[model samples]
Structures are given as C-alpha cells and as structure tokens.
Target: MASAALIESSLSGIPVKRGKVRDVYDFGDRLLFVATDRISAFDWILSPGIPDKGRVLTQISRFWFERFESVSNHLLSMNPADVPLPDDADLEALSGRCMVVRKTEVIPFECVVRGYLSGSGWKDYLATGAVCGIDLLEGLQQSDQLPEPLFTPATKAETGHDENVSFQTMSDAIGQELAEKLRDLSIQIYQQGSEYAQQRGIILADTKFEFGILDGEPILIDEVLTPDSSRFWPADRYQPGGAQLSLDKQFVRDWLETTTWDKNSPPPPLPEEIVSKTREKYFEAYKMLTGKECTW
Candidate 1:
C-alpha cells in the first residue's frame, strides 16, 4: 500500500486524481503530476515498491522532453522556480521526479506508433496477420523491423486496457484533419526517439505518446520515452527468435511469469532482492540512455 503521508504530502493543495501509479493534482490551469513510488505489472499495482523508481522515470521523461523540444511543443515549462509551488513543497528533494506542466484537455485516444513487431503487436500478428487493423508484410518475424513505421491509434479505455483502433476508427472519432495531424506528429516523435536511443546502445522497440489541444493546437502532454511509456531493448542482445532482453521492468515481469499467480488476480509482493535489482535496472537505463547521473 502507498504511504498515507507520502500521498498526502505530495497531493496537498491540489485535487487528487489517482491512476495506477501516478497521482495527478489539478493546479488551476496547470497540473502537478507526481510519480509515486509504486510499481505495476499485468495491470496491477504490486505490493512492494521499487526504490527510486519515480525519480528515474521523471529524469528519463525530462531528458526526452528536452531532446524533442525542437521538433514539437511539449507541456513542460523551463523555469521550475518561477512556477508556483506550495510554500512548504519539498522541491529540492523531489528534483528530477516531478513536473509542473500546463494542463490542457487531453485527447480521448492513445497515440501509438510501432517501428518493430513485438509484444501485443506480435500477438495480433499471429492471430490475424495484422496489428491494430494494419496489415503486416508477409514472413515478418517477431521483433523484425518493419519496412516503415505505422501509426496505429487506439481508443483510450476507461476501465481496462486501451483497445487498439484502426486509423479509420480514429478518423471517425476525431475527424480526418485532426487524426492526420496526430499521426504525423506521432511518427516524427518516434523517429527522433528511436534514432537517439540507437546511438545509446538501446533500441526503442516502440512507444506511446499522448497529446492535448491548447488554444486550438495539438501539444504533447504527459511523459515521453520513459521505460514506463516505452519499451527499451539492449541493441546487442536483441534477437528475433526469442524474447529480447529488456532494460525496463522485465525483471519483475519475468519473475511473475514463473509464479502460479493468475494474471486476473492481484500479483504477489515482490521480494526485496527483486525490488533492489529492478531499481538498479531503472537507474542503469537512465544513465546509459541519458548519459547523466540519476541524482536521486
């Protein structure tokens, strides 16, 4: 369970909106998004928390926000000190783990683009030879890079996992003009992110991005390119025939796979050793991908 003090301290003076792992606060026209020390697997929040997980995620997202600033407009504001934080806010202690961002009305879709076939895409491919209604090239192996990336948008689900929707479906929901713009921006961000990660010995297998409309224009909101939002694979260890080694939460997922716990049931508490190792993996990814220290 999350600590009451931690929750209250973080969400003070803001209307709390609870997600699986993050506690969001509405701060008038802006929002205070706090990454909690919670870990979730199989859509369930695990009992044991991963140390420094929040800071690592925050740092990675900030790094990508900076890297992609030239290409798109993101929700981040550069001057943290100028922003109005609570008087007793522990800003220094929460460095690199939180963001004070301009709040906009979020879109109803989750923008997903895949450069490679894997995970849910692979599952869909084996079932129907298509992913999110996009037909795949024949004989494409698992983890094989596509000839070109595809924009497969999905409708955001309210109570469960996001349901993959076709481009046509997206057009029906948000109209052809806005849908096309979202697709273009999604591919641009993914291309920049994949290229940058490739230089850092990591292959960004795929990633999800969220966008919101501000003053009648689309702006990128929420975190970008973090392990929680994207899948990271070691470039050298990536193999097509088997599961690729991940630099993210693979350790926890793998451990859970070996247990008898049903996926529908709440996951068992992770052991202390597993928690420590997972935290180290997050830290390692931050250092390797960003080329900066995990200060927290």
Candidate 2:
C-alpha cells in the first residue's frame, strides 16, 4: 500500500476531502477529483491495490457523461486542453481516472433507483416485505426484474452506511417539490442508462445517483453510471434466479465471502491474481458497454 505522503506527493497538494477511493482537491471554483488505486470490499478498504482501477472507473464515467449528454446536462467541460493542470504534470498518469469539475453544493440525499431485486433491496424485501418503503409482490426471487423501475431514496449518512428512507421522509428532508423532481429525474436517468446498457448486452440492475445544486438548479455531480455506482451483468448469462454476474468488483466480493474475515473488521488484502482479474473485468465492462477500447 502507498503511504499517505506518497499519494499526496503525486497530487498538487493535499486533498480537501478524502473519501474511501477518491480524493478531492479544492481548485478555486472548480475541483480536481482524483481516483486512486485503492480497492474496498465489505465497506472496508483492503490492501494490495489493483493497478489501473482508477483509470477504468474514470473511463467508464467519461463514457457515460458523453453518452448521456443528448438526454441531460452534466458538469463536464470535456476539454483537457483548457484544464489548469501543472505544466510538468503527467496527464497519462491520471489517465482513465481523474476529472476537473465545477464545484457545486451536493445534495443531502443519495438518489437510488432500482430495476432489479438484489443486495439490500432483496434483504429488505425478505425481512420486511418492503424495499425503500415500496412493497413488492410476494415470491420475488433474488435478481428478479421488477415490473417497473422504482426510485428508492436514502439519507446520506455522515460516516457510515446510508439508511433507506421512505418517500415521505425524503419529501420532509428536501421539501415535497424537490423530492418529486429528484424522483422523476432519477428514474428518467436510470431508464435511459438501463436501456442503453441493455442494447450493449449488459443489464444495469440498479444504480445510485448524486446531484448538486448550481445556481438554484440541480445538476449531476460526482461520477455517473460507473460500475462502482451500479451493478452490471452480462446480458447473455443473466438468469432470473441465483446471483447475477457483476460487471465490476464482483470478484473482490466473492473472495471476501469465502473467507472467515468478519465484515466488521478491515478486509483482507487481495492477491495479485484477484487484482488483475478485477482490473480486466472493469475494462471488459467498459468495452462491452461503450464499444470503445479503454486506451488507458
């Protein structure tokens, strides 16, 4: 693992905010979002970093931003030449992983939309017969496609996992009008992304979106449509029963499940083979979904 100082030396300065996998540096009115090589599983940051993980995620997000521009506006300048990067900076080093974005006040909630039953939704359904406060028909199996996509809003927790909240709770948090707008826009974005992925032989099972307010208008912020934010399954192998193959970090999760390491403690380090395979999976997903090679 790279030391914190080593990571900091690679950047212009220390990050203003350090998340699990990305680092954010304040750059005047804009921000530099740098995706690191770190990999996390079971909500824990593991050892033995995966090479090019950042690049793969960055490429995936960039591809989606371009693809969705016809349907909605994203906070992207899309001009590498205009960015105020250091003269001696190695842009290639940051390839497939970094973005210079206009800074905006992020929303308080994580707008999650689901088209399939799995993960927390499946657990919630099995336990309480509801998912994000939406009741499902009895006998819905894992990975079963829902009749229609549903907007399952959640409150963004400060330092831990987010909690699913009812629609009424969301409305109370952000007012009825904004909540309604968020729901509508979330479902619209999901539908467009899901449909596009389906055409490319990938099933966008579900994904979470984050929005920010800029000039009193809501604009998409953070990464969009990446494997980190959504589950991608190969269309050819997808079945209504059993667990669906993930297009992203499914390998890491599978390895963790096999070990006796408790989810509460830090996850074990990934072996070189697992890291390489995971990186390949990410690249394969990008190529399959966008029909473009991941040059990085």
Candidate 3:
C-alpha cells in the first residue's frame, strides 16, 4: 500500500473550493471533485491521512452511481481528464480519485437516513424516546435496527458538525412538497443500499445524501454511500446492545479518544498502526462491496 496521502490538490489559476475531504474546482456549467485522502474526526482534519482513502471513496460512489444510472445525479464522468484543467495540473495524482460533474444550485440541508439506532440517534432516543421528532419504539437498544428507516435531515455547516432537524423543520424551511420528495427519495435509496450491503455481509447502518436543483428538478449531488458519509459495520460481528465494528473513520476517532490532546486544539498525528488499519478497512469495504481489488 502507498503510505503517502494526497491531502490537497493543486490546479493553478482554477477557482477551487476545498472541503474537509474534497477539493472542488469550478467550471461555468460543471465542477471537478477531487477526493483527497484527507480524513477528519470530531471536526478536525487529522495529520497523515490514510493512503488510497480517496480512491476507495471515489470508486464506491462511482459503483453506486452506475448502478442507479436511471436516477438523476450530478456525475458526468469519473475521469478527471474530462474536465478542463491547467496545462500543468497533475492528472496522474487525480486519477481514480476525481469526478467531473454538473454544477447545480445546492440545497442547504443534508438528507440523512437512519436504518439502525446509533450515534446521535441513539443519544436522542436515550433522552427523548425519539429521534428528530419522530417517536421510536421504547426498549430499543443502541445499534438496534429500527422498524423502518427514518429521514432525519440536518442543516449543513461549513466548519463544524451539522445540526440535526426534524422533517417538519425541513418542511418549514423548504416547501412541504420538496421536503417530502427528498424524504421519500432518501429512504428509498437507503433501503436499496442497505439490502445490497447485507447480501455482501456488510451492514449499511445510516448515510447522508446531498441534493441540488438542476433544470427545476432535484438531482443527487456529491458523493453517495461512501464511508465518509455512512456507517458500515461487519454483518458477522453485529450486535444491537452497543456499537458494532465500523469500517469508517470511527476507528481513527476511537484511537483519538485514548489520547490526552483536546479536540479543541490541533489533533495529534495518527500513529503508523492506526493509519495502516484504517487504510485496510477502507480497502476491504471497496473489495467487498464492488467485488474487485483496489489496485490504486
């Protein structure tokens, strides 16, 4: 495995916006998304990202986009060369980790779907017997599967954690019609993804989806079903009593919790063991889901 991580991408003279994990370059009608190997936990981008992490994310999104090609999305081409770039741009570094997509007027809320009781949902259930205004059944334990998936949207944040909001809150912010459409779409996709993962011995617990307006219609935007946006657990080791083994950055976050460094300050660099294990988990997910080796 390559130990070096591409934390950022350089496209001189091109207008670019860098997110925590992706570098998006602006074109008049299209955008170029480069998934750098940068990893973040607790709102902090940690040092020395897991190698080939970007490739795993990009490929996984590509796999799903192709599977659901009938669904409206922003993906145009996975090849970075399809987009215009500076003559001196490093296309080699961008290969297998970038997508050229149509630009749209982005919606401000994250369309989140939860099929399992975990994370903030667990916290909310423990406190209120509900998650985001939707009452859940009593006696549900952490990591327990819900009777059905819930569409819990959140206000998008540029720098920190996204604030979870109720479906009614989302309906109030956007029109009721649009909010309902997004909710239905999110749950449908989540069901398809969760079922597919189960067949592969993996559990797609929950995930976030982004949408944007294009030609007066909502189309899926940004990465889809990637580890960075979803919680994936091994099916064989599944347990509803507590947290299950995850294939995402939660492993890195677990290691950070054992450290003395405060999250408000700059996080400590990940040790070699953590980096290697995290990288392996990502690659393993790619292989299991797509049934192909991650050559990158």
Candidate 4:
C-alpha cells in the first residue's frame, strides 16, 4: 500500500488554517507548516495523494531556505521533535514533511517573478505586449528569455483564480515603497535561483513567493522555490517559441488536459501512471538540485 496522505493536521494548542497544500497550525508566536502530499491543480486538490510528494516539496523548500539565509525566511526547523505537535498527532507521519515556522502577518500579494515568456505571462505578452503592465521588447517568442526577470505581482485570492496586476496597481494597494521593495527582492531571488538551477541543468523559468511582516520587517513566509510554486524545465531540452517539458507538476497538468472533465468543480482522480510519473519528476528535481536522493 502507498503511504497515507497527510491531508489534515490538527493539534491541541491552536487553530489550524488549511491552505491548498499546507496544513498550518498556529503556535502562538510561530506556526507549524505541514506540506501535504495532496496535489492541487487549477485550484482543486486532487484525490489519492502522490506518495513522497510532500517530503519532496518540504525538502526542496528547506534546501533553498538554508542556501539563502541572507534573506529573512519564516522557517525555524524541519525536525518533527522541534515542532509543537499535539500528543495525539502522528509523529512518524509528520517527520519529514513538517516545519516549525515563525508566524507573521502574511503579505497579501503573490510576489511572482518571471525570467521567461511562458504560461500566463506568455498569454499576456501576446495579447498586451506586456506582463503586469511592464512593457517588453516586441516579437518575443513563447519561451524566450525576457530582457530581465519581471516582478509580476498578483492578488492572493481565497477561492477561484489569482488575478495579475500592474506594479502601479500593487503600489496603490500597499504603498509605493513597500511595493518597490517586494519587486526588487522578488527579482533578486529569482535571478539567483535561475542561475543556480541553470547550473544544475534545470531552467528556473519563473516562481512565486509569499512574504509577511515580522516586527515591522518584511520576511519570507511559506514554502520557497518548490515545484508547486515554480516552473522548472530541463535546460538541455529548453526551446523558445513553444512549451518546454518541465521537472515540476506540468506532467500532471498536461495529463489532466487530456481528460474530458471540465476545468470546473470536482476534478477527476489522476491515473496511476500520471501519479507515479509526477512523483518521479518531483523527486528528480529534488535530487538534481540538492545532489541527494530524498531519503525521507
């Protein structure tokens, strides 16, 4: 039998705020973030969780979070013993997929940075000649590298899809200074990650980040640089003007597209082949980037 999915986590001390992929339990001044194997696509959490998916996601986040200590992050520890788990909670189940995190007032927007023309960015560029209201050079292909990474911020919607917005629109929502800081930090992080992933033969096409305020200082909150939050393409096979094969969740998304189910409510369960292939992709990314198999 496959490993049991950690879809919901509840502890004694505090209330839990469940997101699309994480089960977050408040810890007074901190929080326990548990990466669940439950895969979400087009906003719906798919059934029959992919085994080892949560561990891969959590470990990947830990790798980047440690590598970039120069930036303030919410992570405290990935060790289960360090977390404030309830007496009844399953210790073995939570071991590798959980983190003890510093709690903060989370920033409202998704700090997205794109280094390539793809996905929604490509669609927007083809239609408006810009992304998030930032104009780009004309005649750019579908996967062409942008002049530079663009900080495309979007609203963090509770339900439905996230709406992309202009930098000016972000500034209008949350002061110009704060907006500028987020944009700069986002671009800087993406640049460094792109460089690093490229060295490992993976194209860090684009990624989104979440931030929050801790004692009046902006800090990185939530998972960073995981396959769920970023687009990772094999560098060797990367080509412009078309879709690139990815080492992320794109495999599953591509499979889903073939199904007759509408992109509305109640998505169909993934086939065994798709599940296994996607798990392999996630693990491949973790191994390729960290140079070690996910022993957990």
TM-score of each: 0.91, 0.91, 0.98, 0.96
Q: Write the per-residue lDDT of candidate 3 for residues 12-128, one digit (tens) a residue.
A: 998999999999999888999999999999998998988889989999999999887767999999888887788999878898999999999999999999999999899999999
What are the per-residue Cα lDDT tens digits for candidate 4 across 1-296?
A: 45766666556666888888888887688778888888988888898788878888899999999989899998888876675567788777887888898989888899999999999999998899988688898989999998888888999987668889888888998899999998898988889889999999999999999999989888888889999999999999998989999988878888888989798869998888888888889989999999998775
Off by over 4 Å in 4: none
Per-residue CA lDDT of candidate 1, range 1-296, in tens?
31211322263575778776667777678776777667777778787777668777777877887878665554565334545766777765455457778878789999998988888898999899998788877788888888888888888765467888888988998889999999999999999889989999999888889898888888888878887877889898888865688878867888999999998977788887887777778888899898887766
Pairs in steric clash, model 1: none
What's the TM for model 4? Answer: 0.96
**Of 1 and 4, which scores higher on TM-score?**
4
lDDT of 3: 0.91
Q: Tell me the number of clashing residue pairs for each predicted model.
A: 0, 1, 0, 0
Give the number of the best model, judged by lDDT. 3
Number of the top TM-score candidate: 3
By summed lDDT, the worst window of 10 consecutive residues in model 4 runs over 1-10
lDDT of 2 by residue, 1-296 (tens): 41221132155543468776777767678877778777766667778767777767777787777877753434465443345766766666565467778888888999999999988999999998989778889999999999999899888764567888888998997889888988999899899999999999999999999888888777777778887788899999999877988887766888888889988876777777787777778888889987987665
